[model samples]
Target: MVEKEGFAALVLRLRAEGISDLDLLTAVEQTPRSLFVPPQFAEQAYSSRSIPIECGAFIEGADLAVRLLANLHVKPGQRVLEIGTGSGFIAAVLGRISERVMSIDRYKMLIGAAQRRLDSLALRNVVLRQADGSNGLTGEGTFDRILATAAFPSMPRFLAEQLVSGGVLLAPLMTGEETCTMVRLTKTGSRFDREDLFEVPYLPLVPKVASFL
Candidate 1:
């Protein structure tokens, strides 16, 4: 069973850890982490640690998700794109703040599960799809913000083109065989300014066809 006080404490701890965005904090509080995790691990859902979900994916801990959201600086009425939709937790949080969120995952099972979770929460602003995130959403035009929950060998070229000028793109850039660093790229004119934020581990970004076998 999950304790309400424990969950509230975790949120408070995240605030102490520099999550100053009120909206993001509220989203974290509103969305129960247990709902997004495997039922077997529901008791540990609010423990401020990553939990494994379906399709060999891990839902980022609440603190990490809040930190990423803070860096993205999502705003109301802004279009956002998320590369990985694991458990749809982050997408649901973004939907609370952004005008609309388009999330893509290569795994069909994960997409279906995430979509159901978001729908249960009545988060109508998010659209979930199963597609290769590396290529981004073609023919969908540009987005005000783009985020990748997976790590790539390096910054993807296609994502840069899909971002609107002055938009922010946050993703984990692999720095070593088993290590990665979070990078923030701000699109400026035809160029993007890169800033290395911090180190974090994430599943490698890959392009895979959705399978329903």
Candidate 2:
């Protein structure tokens, strides 16, 4: 297992890598990645890499989580929505920066496991649910910011509609050739402005109904 000092050093390395957002760095420090992973993988939790959680799901790399959080531009008291709650690490980080966070995953096992971790951390502002993330949570109404950890072939219109005007949505869009690229969409009035952020590798965004039990 990594000691506290080692975890702090990892955060410092992330800072040197251009993640200048102080809030994100602080969140990373506050939420030790080791606590969110399985006991066997605790040693590699603080490493700058992704870890498989369960049912083919993964806990995203700490650096990538910071990049997504930075791009979302989340503010205190803002309501944010996260599509994948693997290990609930990113959702907890979002909770640290925002007033409320609703994170949904298709797998019940993952949601249950993540909920325990979040509860142990006393993150009351984050709500975890087991549902089809691709459909988004329209019943929860519009969100100030939305982030999808999984990659999709195309933007889900339902998710776009759930964004409040002037809201920002970040997700990885996959090309026909199976390459993934990060995309940022800002909802403006009835239309949206899209910007391609960068290329990244992410798991496919699968719906609950589409998943094999």
Candidate 3:
């Protein structure tokens, strides 16, 4: 199994690669990726590559999340929403940067397992639920930030409507040749500006009411 110090070394590399946020770097360092993956691959936890976990899920690449969060102007007391909880690694990372975070996944089992991991880590600010992440969170008129780990063919209109007037939404928008094009949508009055940050490959967003994408 990878040692905690080994993961720290990886985070340090990520930092040198242009991720300068200390809070984010620390979150990625402190959150144990090994705990969320299957026991067999626990040794590869912090290797910077995706590994399969239970329920046919794959842990998200830390670099992808690092690229997304790098553009987010998230504050410590901000309320954030994370879609596609996956192995809950990103959610754990988000927990360190926000006061309250709600992460949704289409798989119930993933949520259950993630909850146990979060509980074990004593991460109390994140709430996990089984729901369609593409549709965005309901009843929340505004959010300080919205992050999606899943790739969407097009930016969901619901997500656009949910962001606060000046908030930002980070997700992978599918573009040609690339599996996903990392884009940031910044809400401005009634319009949003899309900024392409990088390219990535992620599991497709699960449709409403159906899990297992």
- Cα lDDT of model 2 by residue, 116-193, tens digit: 988888999999988888788868989999999789888877788888899999988987577898899999998999
Cα TM-score per model: 0.94, 0.92, 0.91
Q: Give each model's whole-structure lDDT.
A: 0.86, 0.84, 0.81
Model 3, clash count? 0
Q: So what's the TM-score on candidate 3? A: 0.91
lDDT of 3 at 42: 74
Q: Count backbone overlaps in model 1.
A: 0
lDDT of candidate 3 at residue 105, scale 0 to 100: 86
Q: Please identify model 2 stretches exceeding 4 Å from their true place.
A: 1-3, 210-213
Model 1 residue runs over 4 Å out of place are: 1-3, 211-213
Kindly list the per-residue Cα lDDT of model 3 for residues 1-213, writing each as its tens digit. 365765776777677787778787777767877787889877777676788876677886656566667788788999999988888888888898889899998888889899999999999999998887768899866788998878889877788788989999988887764578778999999989988887777767757654543
Overall local distance difference test of candidate 3 = 0.81
Residue 159, candidate 1: Cα error in Å is 0.4
**Which run of 10 residues does model 1 get worst, by summed lDDT?**
204-213
Q: Write the per-residue lDDT of candidate 1 for residues 3-46, one digit (tens) a residue.
A: 47656777788768777677777777788888998999887777
Model 3 weakest 10-residue run by lDDT: 204-213
Candidate 1 lDDT score at position 106: 88
